[model samples]
Target: MRWAPPGFGGKRRSPEEIKREGWREQKVLVVSETDPRLTWPERELVRQLGDKLYGYRKEARHGRLDP
Candidate 1:
């Protein structure tokens, strides 16, 4: 997901470098179950869906997703 400059060898790129490089970036929303607006079941469903989507997104970004 990242490439280093020629003649520059070291550990993997840091989060700062990744951001500076302008790679695909996403902002995740945080919703707490404690929010009175959402019932318990609704919160659970949202949490599960968010987790699944995150996994799929990460895999797709790294070219690991299946056809």
Candidate 2:
């Protein structure tokens, strides 16, 4: 099951909506210094999907989802 936004009345949502939901999750992947494996396109995809991206090892140390 999933929680939809206030205005989502349809049976399904677009990938952007699903990705946006993933960004709202309580956990996520955090990288340090930007992984070389993440190509420009891949990075852009993540950026488009996520609320924000951080590069702080300190934050990662705490957890990927910590505010």
Compute each candidate's TM-score over C-alphas: 0.31, 0.27
Give one digit per residue, the lDDT tens place, for model 1 in 1-67. Answer: 7888986877778765655455445553455545678988998787667657654445334645443
lDDT of 2 by residue, 3-60 (tens): 8787786666776567566667945444423557788888766654453454434544
Scored by lDDT, model 1 comes in at: 0.62
After superposition, the stretches of candidate 1 with alpha carbons farther than 4 Å from their true spots are 1-34, 56-67
lDDT of each: 0.62, 0.58
Which segments of model 2 are wrong by more than 4 Å?
Answer: 1-33, 52-67
What is the model-wide C-alpha lDDT for candidate 2?
A: 0.58
